[model samples]
Every structure is written in structure tokens, then in C-alpha cells.
Target: MSEFLSHSHPRVALIGECMIELQQHANGTLKQSFGGDTLNTAVYLSRLLGSAAQVDYVTALGDDSFSDAMCAIWAEEGIGLSRVQRLPGRLPGLYCIQTDAQGERRFLYWRNEAAVRECFTTPAADPILAALPEYDVLYFSGITLAVLGEVGRARLLSTLGDARDRGARVVFDNNYRPRLWRSVDQARQAYRAVMHEVDLALLTEEDEQALFDYADSEAIMSAYRDMGVSEVVIKRGAQSCLVRADNRRYEVPAHPVHNVIDTTAAGDSFSAGYLARRLRGGSPQEAAEAGHRLASLVIQHPGALIPRSVMPA
Candidate 1:
């Protein structure tokens, strides 16, 4: 159904923040880059779908050198920048990634004062919110909801409703971070409010367990069905991804990886791959395969954005 909602040349708009990323290497050196969950998904989707979709990112950033560089890099990846908001004298958020010997990653964030917290509250956001319904699809994650606060969350809910009414597909990813929200109850309220409006949900099993404390995958799937989500995909790392669509279920196994260098952006890339295939008129099973394939490759390399040259054909 989501695939059928788009025109021949679909326009995809992802709402979230991109932060200054610093990664520690084995040699005790730090490598700088820019990445966020939605941003990573946007880049990979742009690469995979190519001319099939017009991918855009919507977020607020400071008018600083880092922001400028981030925009330029996004443009180089062929992501649209028409919805990006530049707040004066404000800086984008920053985070550091440290990976242990097992390739597991940990992050330390400095984003309390990031400009994206004001994404839908500023004057410039009026146009961005208004323009959201014009896109064929609107993609956002749990983190996007957390940073918006109460006021901005209300604004977002209104916009999402309007967008859905205008025949736009609303896609959500459950990338839950417990530390971002004030309390579990508040987070659950926000998630429940938006769940009813979502057309497709890309959920992680661990996140669902952490947030809603579901007993198992069936419980999570039942919750999503009750929320009126037409399509649901549950991603389990190194395991199978379960897809429920068209009143049928499909389980696709994760692709095998010989070496795991870094686990960063694995789920983000998987969502991108799945969305890219779905937008291109593929079935749920096929989308899951594509997602697993891409994620397997991502974990074999370091950082969020892997080299374009190494992209699978």
C-alpha cells in the first residue's frame, strides 16, 4: 500500500537531526564526520534508489562551518536540502562514538542545546511544516519525537495528520533511546499518539521490548496492529526480520558477514534499504532481504556512511 501511494517519481522527506560525529580508532585517533539515524537512512536511500526517489532531510541547524559542511556533503550524496532550516548563531549537536574490541559501540552526546530541538518552533518552521504534506512520504524516528518536546510534538502530530489526509505515507522507525525522554509514560504517550497515524512501521525488537515491555515479537506485532499500522517490520540483529503486510507474514534471514568492524548505523541502513525497495514497488519479503543485505555490509565497515564505491551492485 505504501508503494502504491507514490507517484512515478516519489519525493521522500525525512525529519531528524544530524550531529557532528567523532569516532575513536584503534590507534587512539579521532575521525570526524556527520551522521544521524535519519540522515544515514537518507544517504543510503538516495544511493540505493537513485533517480527513483527524491530524498530530502528536514531539520534545524546552526549557520556555522560544520552545518555548512554537512549540507554540502548531503548535496554531494544527492539528498535534497530545500527543507533544511538554518538557525542563526546556533550550532548543531555533537557526539562521540567509542567501539570496543568486539565492535560494539557506545556514544556520548552533547545535544541538549542543539538547534534541532527548535525545529518546529521557530518562524522558519512554518513553511517547512506546511510543505511536509506535499511529499509522497514522510519518515521519522523515535529520536525525532523525543527532541521535539511537548509543544513541538503537538505541532508535528498536527502536520502528520494533515500529511496523511493529503494522501502522503507516514513511515516510522522505533529507534528508542531511554535517556532522551523524561519518563517512560511520556514517551509511550508520544509514541501512541503518532502510531495511529503511521502507514508503515519499521520497528526493532529490542526497542519495542525496552519501551513497551512486550513479552515477545507476537505481542509487539499485536500492538502495532491495534494501533492501525497497515504494515509492520520487526528487525532483530543477526536474526531474521519479520514482515507483516497484505495480511501475510514473511521472515527473512539476516545476511552473513565475515568481519564486523563497527555496528554503527546498521539498523539505519537496514531501514533505508527496506524503504528504498518498498518505494520501488518491491514486496515486503524482498524489502527485508535488501535490508539485511545492506546491514550486513554496513557492519563490515567503520562509521555510518560507508564508501559509495563498495556499494553492492
Candidate 2:
């Protein structure tokens, strides 16, 4: 049974940064939007679950026009902003995406001084940190760890431990970006510190290899299992995704997408779908299938977010 199914309306909080996204078109045009790995998942999860759950985003953003716009959009999607902190005189990070002829996207970031770097550290953040353990589920990604500097990361680790002790399920996604961290060793250490407390781990095989240099899929699963993660899903692009939980392993084939316009938020959307279904009392196999279905539709579009009308039925 899904843990969330026991509650009337599960409260989910996803902690990460949402940056100003500038998508460079082939015709030399730039389109502005807001996107981040965990933010993408938050939006998708809110969309899929609707009033079935209370979805919230936990991050600090500047009291600026861009931040205002991002919050407006998230509110339109029905994502709660009670946990979002608006810091004065600070600004959200920015990133630009350039896609090639083959629809492969590359990103350039300007996030060194983003307001979210002070996410869990500032004086105003004390209450937010205290409130995190009250949520039924807390979701974050590797990128979340990277943005929260050393002090913030330490605070997050202590909070996660307390959250888990209070019976809150901790979910993690390995959305690793090498450019975000100071060093591989530092990233590894930070990841390991939180892994022991994670209940469900959504991993990308490529990231596992890049970060840990795992020999193969089995090694990655074994490493996560050793860290005490109860559930692990290894996402392999264009191939089947593997899920291991309760000492059983299953492989669900990916939904085929013939026209891949852009693969921007494939993994993030998959995580959202999987978590949505799993939270709604779906089996692990059903959750993986939901993940593939949403990811297939997402990659057919050009940007991270597909239109609300085109959502999978």
C-alpha cells in the first residue's frame, strides 16, 4: 500500500531552486520561463494530483519581477507557496538553454548569487525548517543539495534526519550537474549524508555513473541499498526503467516517442508521474508505467513544460 494513501490529503514539499529560463530558439529568439529539476516535478505533481494532495515548493526567491512571475505561475498550477521565502534585494538564478538540430539541449547558468543559496540559513528560514517535518512527504534532488552551500546543506541534513524520525517520507532524485558542485568528492559526501535518510530514491543511470562511476546498474542499486534506501528506481533514457523495492526487482519498458523535439525535463516529469501514481495507491509497476507515459509526452514538446491541454489522459 502507498504510504500517502493512508492520509486524507497528503502534504508534499519539494525543496529546490527555480531559475529564470531563457530558451534560445533556432530563429535567434529567446523565450523566458521558470524551470528547475525539482520545480518541474512540483508543477507536474500538482497538475496530476490536483486537490488530491497539497503540493508545496520550499525555496527562497528574490522580491523581484521575475520571482513574482514565477510565483504567479506556480499558484496558477495550484502549488502552495506558504513555504516559499521572498528575500529582499536578492534575485533568483538565471539559465539559458541552447538546443541543437537533434533537439539536444545544453544549459548555461548564472546562479552563483541566487537568493536560494540562503535557503535554509537566514534568520527568517528558522520557522520554515521547523515546519518541514510536519509534511507527510519531502522531495528534493541533487541540485537542491548543490545550491544549499555548506552551511545550508548541514542544516538540511539535520532537518531531514528529524523529518524521517517523525515518520515523514524523504524522496530524492539524483539530478546531478557537475558544474553546480565544487568537486566530485564534495558532491559524493553530501549525497551520502542524505541517502541514509531517503525512503525513495529516483536515480538516473547516467548521473549515477558520472557521480559515483558505478560499474553498472546493479552496482548503483547495490550502493543505494547499502545506504539504507528502501526503494530505488534507475531511469535509463530511451530504455526500460528498473525499480527495486521490498526485495523485488521489476523493469518497465519506456513509452516510445518517435518525435523527440526536446528532452529537457524527461527525467523530472517521470519522477513526478511515478510519485503521483505511487502516492495515489498505485503499485510500483503501475507507477513506473505512469512515469514512462508522462515522460514520453514531455519529450515530444520543445520546452520543459508541455501545455496543460496536452496532458496525458
Residues 1-313 of candidate 2 have per-residue lDDT tens digits of: 3443466679999999999999999898999998999999999999999999999999999999999999999999999999999999999999999998777899999999999999999999999999999999999999999999999989999999999888899999999999999899999999999898899999999999999999999999999989899889999999999999888899999998888899999999999999999898888899999999999999999889999998887
**Which lDDT tens digits does candidate 1 get at residues 92-152?**
9999999998889999999999999999999899999999998889999999999888889
Q: Which stretches of model 1 miss by more than 4 angstroms? A: 1-6
Per-prediction TM-score: 0.98, 0.98
Cα error, residue 29 of model 1, in Å, equals 1.6
Runs in model 2 deviating more than 4 A are: 1-5
